[model samples]
Target: MIEYVARSGPPEAMNCPAFICDTCRNQVVAEGIVTWATTIGRDGDRGPHQQTPVYVAHKGRCGRGLELWIEQHYPAADGWIDLWDDLEDFVCQLTHNLTNAFADDTEGTYHPHRLVHPKERR
Candidate 1:
């Protein structure tokens, strides 16, 4: 995630054109895969919900396009790059009112997502 942000420079990720693919470290030019991950809250107090989306190419494979087709359906939880396709909504569900995104998604298909678009890039 940090790598993507550091490399990709951004105003925000939500509805943006694309994000970095963790596997290939390139821009996901169009629709890509989304998964989940698990992380221990920073303060060990459930961290007040998860943060940020990590991106990767779909099926362990890379993709190509004009790099301006898919508008981000969600925002990076903390504002940086995108790996989470639905990060904004996911974070909201989890942090808002102390709700949980797929039960904190700590278990099953966890990545806080396979949906961090699966893991934080770099």
Candidate 2:
């Protein structure tokens, strides 16, 4: 099971809420976490403001527990065409997308994490 712990930054900064997983209970900082930022429109006088949301998973026996959790939660379709045969690849891709979303200046939306089914790309 996954447990969630809320985190916050200084009040001065517009830091969004961050979540920590307690299932695995690891000391690593942001080891298995996803953080994204988006802009919210303000009043006509004020410009849009940025909002960030962070998610972190607890450390499990192995570092790949997050991958396993995702797989279990979102099972692959039968005969799916997976770009990667190992869980590490999935984890890498997820982290890469998350990083990109966090750094994205215009679009801060997170890319969906999913496997391509057979012939689905065409």
Top TM-score model = 2
lDDT per residue (tens digit) for residues 32-67 in model 2: 443222223323323233332222444344334544
Model 2: how far residue 25 lies from native, Å: 4.9
lDDT of 1 by residue, 19-90 (tens): 566556666543565443333343354333443343345433342221111123233343323234343454
The residue pairs that clash in candidate 2, if any, are: none
lDDT of each: 0.39, 0.38
**TM-score list, all predictions:** 0.26, 0.27
What is the TM-score of candidate 2?
0.27
Candidate 1 lDDT score relative to the true structure: 0.39
Q: With candidate 1 superimposed using the best TM-score fit, by how many Å does residue 85's alpha carbon deviate from the native?
A: 6.1
